[model samples]
Target chain A: MPELRQEPITKNWVIIATERSKRPSDFSVKKEKRKGGTCPFCKGNEGKTPPEIMAYREKGTKPDTPGWWVRVVPNLFPALAKTGAGETHEQNFYLTKPGAGAHEVLIESPEHDASLETHSQQHVREIFHAWRDRYQALINEEPIQYIQIFKNEGSIAGASLEHPHSQLIATPLIPPVVDEELKGAQEHYQEHGNCIYCEMIKHELGVGRRIVAKNDHFLAFCPFASRFPFETWIIPQQHQAGFDSINDQQLHSLSIIVQEVTQKIRGSLNQPPYNMVLHSAPKGHSHAADYHWHLEILPRLTIVAGFEWGTGIIINPTPPESAAEYLREVNTNLVEEKERLSWQQVH
Target chain B: MPELRQEPITKNWVIIATERSKRPSDFSVKKEKRKGGTCPFCKGNEGKTPPEIMAYREKGTKPDTPGWWVRVVPNLFPALAKTGAGETHEQNFYLTKPGAGAHEVLIESPEHDASLETHSQQHVREIFHAWRDRYQALINEEPIQYIQIFKNEGSIAGASLEHPHSQLIATPLIPPVVDEELKGAQEHYQEHGNCIYCEMIKHELGVGRRIVAKNDHFLAFCPFASRFPFETWIIPQQHQAGFDSINDQQLHSLSIIVQEVTQKIRGSLNQPPYNMVLHSAPKGHSHAADYHWHLEILPRLTIVAGFEWGTGIIINPTPPESAAEYLREVNTNLVEEKERLSWQQVH
Candidate 1:
């Protein structure tokens, strides 16, 4: 069984696979260090994967079939599983517990190469729906406290498959990152009676230097202290603490904003690899003024070496103002023109 | 001027370059994307770099000469510098400060390709001395509060130059990561009257499941919460708060143990890219049993993707016990055989 071990000092948890441990030489035999030619996420290869957990399919299509558009399947190699009973195992200074959770991959489109930027807004909206649906479903589980929704866009961004997909991993613990954010948000609420993210959105709009895109209900901007080059955040204009609190209007607005921001990035950087993540309050936490959920898109343009690892601080070469200026000026229409052919094929 | 921008919520500082703002295309024009030729870090190319900040030279040899066995030079493009006055700039929701610090490179050897594993013990010892020497010197500077010493071994590990070198970036502020570590250590000390790391060392020694290399004064092990595959921590056996407090006896032991551990890694994995970092408490706050500084060596065997970025948790495939077992059994003779020829040429 893979056990989650917590580092005493930093309180960081690491998953250690004891049962099926890999040797040093195992890293060298990486199946695909380069391009993955044929993707199992494609339309006809539904049987190649485990049966779908939840998928959007045509009326006549079976569970594991070719007609699904947005499909969720169990990861071939799951980092965490739902099999383990809820238990905490501990030694003197080392803490261990079974990694009991869900690791599911959400195939965004039947087309292997289709991305949110390349797909239609309606298609992108479905992905958001699926994410919310998974989050709501996972939260109902007894042991699950948090569900992390993230996407690795390219090979360098840690996507082994070239296919466009997102991942949802439900964990029994509220991860330290989210915990820290919650603590900070709670602190802010205590001091000022306002969500910090709400203040940030208002501040960014007032400054206008770091605003990348804004819609009726959503706003996207290069973060003031972005850890990566061209790192951007998309947040709801309203103060909703959890992602589950998002309504139909906000979801529609988010779909448009997500597409626009990603389109700007792709058009500007020629589609550099990136990681996108959704941050939300933990389960049982209601929509309060204390916290607000948002999404972070980190462009994997630089190598995070020793400095970043040792110190939590980051050395961002591009200033957020400049990044916002550049991204704001990019013709998202270029992506539209480029996606026209792929869009036709998907239809 | 480059500014240190702090994220208001997390209190994470980022170095934002304001002067030489890299455009979208500037990052694409990265030098030495492939194999480097006529290397500037080579012995004869002394004039190519900024004048030596510090160098260990043979007797009667002048500065920037070929006689130096070890050298330290200022990074041509420093991320942070000593130019800014200590002042804070605050916008509504964002905080900024002057990026006043020191950034320099410690050339490990005169030879371009010589690394710690392949270099003789004597040569590697000098590199450690140079690290301490620079740290001591930089800490005495007025605005410098902490110095982060690190080495990136390969291009994938963020080494633009193939030349073996380590970096020291002194900062004016105590970084958030170190702060969190200090907070955790203090909490541990307050509750248990012990340093958490000291407790960890004792615990690991008692269990012996994750021990990699050990000597009288120092022990290296895969951390209980191993964030990276084959991630190892080299901690002092004796409970000392800081890395700078080490004497001659400990340095000698550290040199051997470092060489042994790297040799084991190289012998078993065929010389993979890695990043080594020295973590120490901030100045004016050390040697008081409150913090225990150690060196972290992270092998760049896996890519950090969305899950890690989003959750601040790592999913390591290899168990620490298995990693330690494999590394412990490796023959150090492999590295010794590879170094014999290089050692002769240098002598």
Candidate 2:
């Protein structure tokens, strides 16, 4: 019979369907659908999307016009919106809250093919600054309790629009994932009197096996328990709890590492779809000392199967050390040229 | 830097790679790589896999032969094995454990085209019996702490072989997901004097909006807080915490509901790739009254994006009520015939 299985730590329940099962062949992987049409995110098409909430444009450009390297607009079809600060309602054993939140899309460039790997480092730094700036602005909104800044790079990573962009979702409630991490961090702080993320960085450096790349202010490495193949993380070497806490020099360092790791992945895996998310301390909440903010870049190279979904335990085939070693050896200059050549051919 | 972020609920740590960022167009959906030429799971190819651990065969049929309707064997390339129970080695901030456990494959049928939707109910029941029988046996092994039985239907769902089969992964530690659920159930029982799952089932039945299908001894419903679109759960009417606690009549009823629900899904989504997992109480463990085991069927129609991975909050575009209502109206018999005609054309 189908039964409810509760996850031990998170206390989340998943229903396991036991009765009818399909053969391996019965399930077919459909080709990813790529919508081809006039680019809505491109320059001169600002009218196709919601009007710009914030844009870093040329010295006298209009609000919704061209010449903007970084543009922030509300999601046309947002999962959560600012219009209704709906409260959560309860119905017996089930619990639900209004999805009163803000959703914005950050267009990285005016051109369709301007990827992070192909973009100039200076421009990428502007994108990072834009992310932190929006984060700071959104966190102060009364309805928003959590700000999620994430980028989906391909259809596999859940991007519907073929645009080089990042998304920010400002939710009213603390996201379950973040809440858990906060709790974990707090507990670790109480027990050890140290930031767990900071401790992790210290220990990993001592081990050195999982380190992929490093800059003066930032470090890139593969995690000890990587759930996916070639999963990489980038974090500021100096402990900081919020993305907005970053300074100009830190932003530059962050941008370089981001570009470096991205290029490494493209060169090594020959360009795979990936998802990147910046995780920081919850806004309007204290526990800044306990939590150390970081960015997580997950490459969509493998499928999360039944075992993973059922047990909440991943069975990764590749070891983290091997993945890190392969990425570290990738030639950035060669990869950049190759990416540009590919973009030239496509665009 | 790359660091392990432990999910609070399940305590399952994920490696978050943050440095790399790719464009939406950089990711390419890989074509499902089906290794052609050999049919390893066929009746005559029984020698291809490890020797049978158990099998349901006709009278006088010998082991390692073609007469078995359902067969069980050890995984050739197991993620965790019985040979070495590797103890988790701890680094300063990282935790590592030996993946010492059992991995088994249950071939549902001899034919590649055999699916729960296509196979007779009697045969599927036999497969269920095999699962329980094996579960009972594996739990007694010294290294086995928990058992997980899951089936990946399509390539997207993580099945490499095109055979009709299910996998059994017996782990040395209680998986974080299962552990979290057990704790939740225990706490719920202590406070309310009831099983959380039973309470949930009662509540869901009272509000029939999310219900997909139900039989005499079991109920099938899409949860109010479904993480995925058309994410359905099946539960027994009575509170049975352990799967092995099921008697003959319960098994028969369970098989019927399973078949009905699977048919409904195929009809509703035109046979989208999916993952079905059987979640039962850990064997040789106590706390039976507090926990109730169920099955979860998650359809791969939507992508779990960056927000999902980052915040553990799902943004399902389709609500449970609409999904259940659509599923309830599908003509399963017509869909079955249509499926048969398509199979005939393909094979």
* Per-model DockQ against the true two-chain complex: 0.22, 0.25
Q: Which stretches of model 1 miss by more than 4 angstroms?
A: A1-37, A334-347, B1-36, B334-347
Model 2 TM? 0.87
Q: Fnat of candidate 2, please?
A: 0.46
What is the C-alpha lDDT profile of model 2 across A1-347, one tens digit per residue? 22223322233323222222222223233344455358889998988988899999999889888978899998877767666654655555554555567789999999887789988989989999999899888887877788899999888788888779999988777776788878887888898898878888887777777788777787788877676677898988778888878899999888888998998886567477889988887885533888888898988776788988888776655667767777776778823342221212211
True contacts kept of 1: 0.43
lDDT score, candidate 1: 0.74
DockQ value for model 2:
0.25
In model 2, what is chain B's TM-score? Answer: 0.84
Docking class of 1: incorrect
TM-score of the second chain of model 1 compared to its true counterpart = 0.86
